[model samples]
Target chain A: MTAAAPTDRTRLRRAHERGHHDRATIDAILDATPQCAVGYTIDGAPYVTPTLHWREGDHVYWHGSSASRALRACDRAEVCLTVSILDGFVLARSGFHHSVNSRSVMLFGTAFKVTDPAEKEARLTAFIDGLFPGRTGMLRPNTEQEIKSTTILGLEIAETSAKVRSGPPKDDEEDYELPIWAGVIPVAMQAGDPIRDTRNRDGVELPAHLRGWRWPG
Target chain B: MTAAAPTDRTRLRRAHERGHHDRATIDAILDATPQCAVGYTIDGAPYVTPTLHWREGDHVYWHGSSASRALRACDRAEVCLTVSILDGFVLARSGFHHSVNSRSVMLFGTAFKVTDPAEKEARLTAFIDGLFPGRTGMLRPNTEQEIKSTTILGLEIAETSAKVRSGPPKDDEEDYELPIWAGVIPVAMQAGDPIRDTRNRDGVELPAHLRGWRWPG
Candidate 1:
């Protein structure tokens, strides 16, 4: 794992001291979650579109409809893309001090639409392969016309920050005397039993990697 | 449940038919998730801030630091607030068609700051209690000094819409015959064992509600 690059953009809040800035920390949070809320503005009105995103090094990639207004505005324009995962509920003695454990990343940069045909295909393949791993090899590739109709946007990790809050909540000393339940409820995302497509031909065995997929903690 | 108010802004997506417009659907999705990525523009740059949010009837409220630049710009400005829950992973025969079962609500409205002290306190209490039912009554109320240091912003549900994708993935009829694995992996957030605060005073019984608190599905 690469050490987090020191920059003002990556500062964590005092309450978010558990938040990690290292490359591995950022990648872990991003990889565990597949969707991101892409935020951009059009004519001064803010818009957030939830889309599937895959990470490649410091860059994040997402595709939208050819006619998406938000995508058009994001092309070469500054955008904010955020991914957040709720880890658990934090029950605290004090109401004002209650909080949740979460991992979130906010990247501030300009997005450039990927236009090269071959590059687009590779990135799209990378996107699918990142989520499904070896399964990408078994699928048909994208056609030129299909690739032409999709718009892929990439945002370089220039000024990025990750804020995380973990462990149990801290309560005021006086509030601790109050009878209240307090603890952290751990949340997780796990893979379930594979469902074979009804129309799948006679006997293709499930890939080894996909059969028992488990995300590293 | 109130019928979805018909408006151009609240209309469901044409391409996605399962998206719902009922108020119960919107509120349930919003209430189940406690955090939202608030998108706004400051000095022509886009910023997305993750903050805890709560819904009251058709209005949604969120708060941030009194000194937050993003909060200041968003107050009184048209903003987009989005809350999303990733329910499951959707595996399809085609890579391009792979998706996730998700519930998302997008609100387009102007946000206004709560200036009245009494109203602000009430709203803040409601926000906290909404996340942890019955916890507010057990804790100390916010003082004038504390209230003055927080900024609360509210967005009405005048122009809002929700989109949901559930059940199995929709693969192309032709691709269904491909030799592949396909199905949904259900994801959820659950509670864990409570950790007693080290500073807690002796003999304080845990509140009954907190001990068995479970998020409504």
Candidate 2:
């Protein structure tokens, strides 16, 4: 899938070498984690709210309570949505060169509210079933009131750039001779055993979607 | 240590019950992970940049290349810094109730550039040693040019709030009786074995800091 080219807003100013404009790189980083922070302006002041996000085709979506002021402010307004994953710690011989290995994608665009009730419901269902496929069909259908109380927002994949840093620290040639231990301490997100709710009905065994679930690090 | 009260911006408008104003709650969420996204405006457009951050006393600090335009825009400007950790996935009987367990803190304040060279150096050292403890002392000291080429910015924790959601899914009473599975799949950040720099001189064993280092989450 072709991605939008880097715009002035998405261009990397500092470490331009780490910037990637391809859709493959951007989508991988976006799909690796459901965690994302959406930054938008409310009354000309910047507010960043961390929320769960998912991607469908070329658009990324996030949702909140319909009454959310943050969501209201984002509708038809410019927004910056970022998805990041900490890869590892890059320990170097000097403090200036010390850094963390990470993968991140920063998308710049206008966020519009998913106004159509049917589209909103379908997108919300995709969000849930995206993580645990087939589970959404098994659950009780969402009521009209439930759908009305939620708001989903989406942004196209234009004006986006992905920055990634990995491998050992890059230190000054002279500093490499120092005795300091320099390398990478790899970090990743992992899932522990599932904890069943006490109210769960008997004979409802763990489903296949979650039994084989693994965090995409 | 006491924290600042939630201002008009820091207060949780959606889930007021999940809001926490105490310093312990805010600091733990800040310290658990170094990953942070700094949101600030450039010519009325919001930009969120992911970077490593460390807290000292009641202030949070992050640094970047001296030539960074993002850092320049943030200096002494209204900015929002957020740190978040994804805890688990809350699967419920209905799509509306599906959620993720997470801890996040959003801090709003003006970020000031650390101009004092000595203080900047000390804070940079603290950023490194904050994770590995004593390893900063073992590394070659940062040179004057290195210090001159970095920009360190800090923001006081005067208006901040921590939002946390954990445990099993909270579904409607009638939905809970459905056969769909409901539970929480706990998630955490884990560190793998350290990889030594290929350029290391012979006999430089893994230091105690890296050997015992573990992600706080």
lDDT of 1 at B186: 65
Stretches of candidate 2 above 4 Å error?
Answer: none
Q: Mind giving the per-residue lDDT tens digits that candidate 1 earns over A1-217? A: 5665655445664445665667777777777777688989877678888887888887889996677666888999889999887777776766556677888888878899999989988888888777667767787555677788788999886667777888777877676666665667666555557666555567777776576765323
Global lDDT of each candidate = 0.76, 0.89
How far in Å is the alpha carbon of A103 misplaced in model 1?
A: 1.9
Q: Tens digit of lDDT per residue, candidate 2, span B1-217?
A: 7867678888777788888989999998999999899999998999898888999999999999989998998998999999989899998888888888999999999999999889998998888888998888888888889899999999998899999998889999987788787999999999999999998877899998888779975
True-contact fraction in model 2 equals 0.83
Interface RMSD of each: 2.5, 1.0
lDDT of 1 by residue, B113-139 (tens): 999989988998888677666777877
DockQ, in order, for the candidates?
0.54, 0.83
Write candidate 2's Cα lDDT for A49-73 as tens digits: 8888999999999998989988898
